[model samples]
Target: MEFTAEIDIMPLDALLDPQGKAVSGSMKNLGLSEITNVRIGKHITLKVKAKDKSEAEAKVDEACKKLLANQIMEKYSFSLKELVA
Candidate 1:
């Protein structure tokens, strides 16, 4: 089976996001101050061939934990969808 995976990695709520903060500051400077609570994260997409949905999900989870995210400071999430013709 073929599946598409989307992974998102972001700093934990308790962690400081300097890039997000900087962007927020810039927005305020540009008079777009209405946008608050800005957070920045990464999005990753991949296609995988697995025996089944469960196997595909397991692979994606491993990828997230091993390479997609830094478990110490960032939390990760992923979604998997089977591809149909």
Candidate 2:
């Protein structure tokens, strides 16, 4: 079976995100003041061949934990779905 994984990686709450803060400041300067506490993150999409959905999900989680995100300073989330032929 083929599966697609959609993932999001973001800095941990305890860590400071300079890039996010920079973007937020820029937004305010651009007159978009309603937005606050803006944070930036990464999105990743990949296709995987697995025996089943459960296996695919486990692989995705492992990838996120090992390479896609820094567990100490960042957190990750992912969803897996069977790919349509």
TM-score of each: 0.91, 0.93
Residue range 1-85, candidate 2, lDDT tens digits:
9998999999998888998888888888889988877788899999999999989988998899889998998899988888889
User: What is the Cα-based lDDT of residue 72 in candidate 1?
Assistant: 94
Q: Give the per-residue Cα lDDT of candidate 1 at 14.
A: 96
lDDT, candidates in the order shown:
0.91, 0.89
Each model's total of backbone clashes: 0, 0
For model 2 the TM-score comes to 0.93
Give the C-alpha lDDT of model 2: 0.89
How many backbone collisions does model 1 have? Answer: 0
Instruction: Determine which window of 10 residues in candidate 1 has minimal summed lDDT.
Output: 28-37
Candidate 1 residue lDDT tens string, 1-85: 9999988889999989999988988998889999877889999999989999999999999888888898999998989999996
Cα displacement (angstroms), candidate 1, residue 52, comes to 1.3
Q: What are the per-model C-alpha RMSD values against the true structure?
A: 1.1, 0.9
